[model samples]
Target: MSSNDLEICKRFAAERAVLDREFKGNVVVGIGSGSTVVYVTKCIAETITRMNKEAEKDGRKPDLNVTCIPSSFQAKELILRNNLNLGSLESFPLVDWTIDGADEIDSQNNIIKGGGGCHTQEKILASCSKELYIVGDYTKYSPKLGTNWKKGIPIEVIPVSYVAVKRKIECRLGGEVLLRMAVMKAGPVITDNSNFIVDWRFPEGIDNWKDIETTLKMIPGVVEVGLFIKMAIKIYIGNEKDVKIYDFSPSNE
Candidate 1:
């Protein structure tokens, strides 16, 4: 297949190999919102369809019922496109596995996501999954978090409380805050749940990001931030030839 970058295809292939090899039986799959995760979603649907067809050819049919819960609207569309079974978070609170794409990943496997503006829901789904795997190209990897992908942290804030939240981030926190505007859409960049997005940037040389994360969450208007602290179970860093996987655990800290 033709692609803009050969590495994209390789990353998709590697993720598929891992999922097909590991993920089996009645699995509640979590579909993440992003270009890279798109491939993983496609693989899940393809595997289900293939299994169904194989069962039809045999004397007995099989029930390859893989219920998928999506992270965002984009994810929902992908699931429908593949003719995969759809389930809601309330229906399927626990996911067998989740594969997502990251904007940046640290050595400790912490991630900075929501580049697509699905941070809040993504974080919830990622946290609920029994195993969360992040997929990205070599550019998303860093010795430490917040090195590359410098669009700041994507913060989900209440629509009515945007101004106060912005002030708290800019004036109180001494950071830069930008309300994400709408370009293609009519109104502001509305999330799947119709929430506004605010991108916040802080100064470099921070020892404890956990403190900053805590402070942001304490803000009344702030719903959630893109800083995925210790939520990733594994991350696949796509490079030339093969993909490198990093295991995240508190024991490493």
Candidate 2:
């Protein structure tokens, strides 16, 4: 598919998250990285403005305001461009909600993210939030986590440990691990935290993600794995037609 179509789908998913009407009171929101979340930041800023105007008319003193904590440099820029108040996890460690874009997600609610190399902080922010919601296009919505997301699981690792991690993944876990290369610059793509990312592509799609998640996390020098097991409370998927919301309750999973 064309990049434009994917952008449209991403924006649709972002709109769905912003229009949820869940930010009723004072809220601290964790903003995740990716082209998709660019629209999410805009929607939140516009919504906050509208809410404040409504509060003024209702004589409620225009109390609606949000402090947004960004997961990466790109996400921080989005928040700034929208003129939203920026916050740091240092101050507001616990947030009301988090919105992130995933590379792929499955029916069982497992997610793989970090295609843009922000999974480390994204996972951190999600862990700090009361609710973590994933936003993505229909193409990323898979019946199983690894089928449609050809890029594989993005695993961030310490630079020195890349070789070891790559070997361990291939030998122990049964997947081909390749260091993610930079498109514009030469050499491997470096993350905001100065970590390297390796995409682990299994021969077949994953069946037991929870076990794999644990196994990957056990590897030394592995900062974080893109496999977001049971982290997403809800997922919003967008297509040319409309947006669909899938609830991921423990009982249902």
Off by over 4 Å in 1: 1-3, 6-10, 13-21, 52-60, 185-187, 249-253
Q: Taking the tens digit of each residue's C-alpha lDDT, what string does model 1 give over 95-138?
A: 98887887888886567888899988998998889988788777
TM-scores for every predicted model? 0.89, 0.94
TM-score of candidate 1 versus the correct structure, residues matched by position = 0.89
Put down candidate 2 lDDT per residue, 132-214, tens digits, no spaces: 98898888888887677788899999999999999999999786999999999999999999989999988684588889889
Candidate 1's displacement at residue 37, Å, is 1.3
Error of 1 at 231 (Å): 0.7
Best by lDDT: 2
| Clash pairs for candidate 1 | none
Cα lDDT of all candidates, in order?
A: 0.79, 0.89
State the lDDT at 128 in candidate 1: 85
* Clash total of candidate 2: 0
Candidate 2 clash pair list: none
